[model samples]
Target: ASYPYKTTQQSCKARSSKVGAIKGYGNTLRGDEEGMRQALDTYGPLAAAIHTTTDLQFYGGSSSGHGAGIIDIPSCSKQVDHAIAIVGYGTENGKDYW
Candidate 1:
């Protein structure tokens, strides 16, 4: 036997109803660094998509015998392929990070 996997508008409605209504939603223009920073500063946090690099993929946290520091991939790519949240930003030792 096989089961069919499908989703309908009615099913979406039912599931959404159980979760309650969405409060608000907004977005910043693509490539607009200043706008993204402004939005983050104003709205608290924002969802962000970024290009993942080998350095980022293998980041070994603070317990890896290497203390955690800003992940600075100088040759980082520009193709966005991963989703992340921009909770906050700050400078450390004259370097900035999200």
Candidate 2:
């Protein structure tokens, strides 16, 4: 898609151009945050699945200079549902987060 000339509501159209390719893929241990972090640090981004709910959708974290800490939503499920990529992780304000 052309960023400069693209339309917002353009009808979906078929294209014959190939953008990129996937070299390889694999899985990490279920419910393993450390393993996921290691995989991301060593092999680049990683895709993960988690549960999503109304509370999660509205979470914006604290803004009192504490910075956001590790987000552990115990209510989130282990089953595959929503998919998100783990590009990177680090600590903020002495809090380990992802």
Candidate 3:
């Protein structure tokens, strides 16, 4: 079960060929929070990259008694290190979260 690592473009093409249609937003949403929000509202969900930090790495769920609140890691670095799905957005206790 070994396969060569495909470049991003190759992977995208393969997925499109198999799945039919695929849309790429590219870097158009960079620094565009409002745009991200609109896209989520219109298109359902989006794939996104995010900067990771220790707090985010160990975020336990509210059901685990860790506390039911939005995660806001203020000291997060600007370097993108992880991939995430921007499924939905909302405000929790007056703070925005996605």
Candidate 4:
């Protein structure tokens, strides 16, 4: 399958605004902003980088337990499968992510 299943740069940017737009439960993580924040902090830089239309669409796909809609988080088990913006920074596995 082609990477970044999403169709365009506009759509790619749109996906980031949705928190848990990829969670397993519908609208779940409603109050877990901090948890997501912590995740971004430590793993943001490690998160994949988008440098092209292809890059933007690179991690697009429907994850399991994503519910009946498209608001479920990507699989933590799947590396480089979903696109997330790195708004924060930190280190993990000795990797410098920003």
Candidate 5:
């Protein structure tokens, strides 16, 4: 959650998992266009969910490996189609709401 994690590759991996929980998988979160919309669009639901769950929250694309900080979708990489939500730090942030 501090300096060390930021520089390491774990930063990106950690951030990725954070969002994944919030997105709600299987029948719990219910995957749909809305989930994608909440991610792609501004911080309407997706962002709020992250903030409410974690005090130190951020949203961004993994393509740049700058998760929460990356608001603008990087044009250079199209491989970051996967959306995720960072519930907490160190440990995975589980889903609280649907």
Candidate 6:
């Protein structure tokens, strides 16, 4: 589904019947890439994080975002400042991406 970008905050107007429910939550082993990958393959997508960068801020832009490459930062560590779901992983143009 598509959501229009709103400049101001909007209150939730969703009907209770239409809202999806979360059953429960589980935590993946911390700082374990292989374990996270196996969990994603076995169960489903897991919440993960990546180091934010200025280049990532331009994700919506045309040229810079169109490349078939994976963004990797070797100096990045487990210090997460943001969170996102680990839906799936695959290779694009012979480069593995998440």
Model 3 steric clash pairs: none
RMSD of each: 9.7, 6.4, 8.1, 14.6, 13.6, 4.2
Candidates in order, TM-scores: namely 0.63, 0.61, 0.65, 0.22, 0.20, 0.60
List per-prediction Cα lDDT, in the order shown: 0.71, 0.68, 0.68, 0.41, 0.37, 0.66
What clash pairs does model 4 have?
4-57, 4-58, 21-71, 21-72, 22-71, 22-72, 22-73, 23-72, 23-73, 45-98
Candidate No. with top TM-score: 3
Question: In candidate 6, what are the lDDT values of residues 1-98, reduced to their tens digit?
Answer: 25533435798655556566678776767767777778889878787777676656535423534332466545766566778888888877787666
Q: Flag the better candidate by lDDT, 1 or 6.
A: 1
lDDT of 4 at 46: 27
Q: Could you give me the TM-score of model 6 versus the true structure? A: 0.60
lDDT of 6 at 45: 76
Clash list (residue pairs), candidate 6: none
Model 1 Cα lDDT, one tens digit per residue, 1-98:
14322322334323223655558989888867788888988877898888877675546545752336788877646688988889888889999777
* lDDT of predicted model 3: 0.68
Q: Write the per-residue lDDT of candidate 2 for residues 1-98, one digit (tens) a residue.
A: 26432324676666679897899987887767888887888889887766776655545455632334456666756566678877888886786666
Model 4, global lDDT: 0.41
Clashing pairs in 1: none
> Which residue pairs of candidate 2 clash?
none
The TM-score of predicted model 3 comes to 0.65
Which parts of model 6 are misplaced by more than 4 Å? 4-18, 61-69
- Model 5: per-residue lDDT, tens digit, 35-63? 54555444433422221222223432345
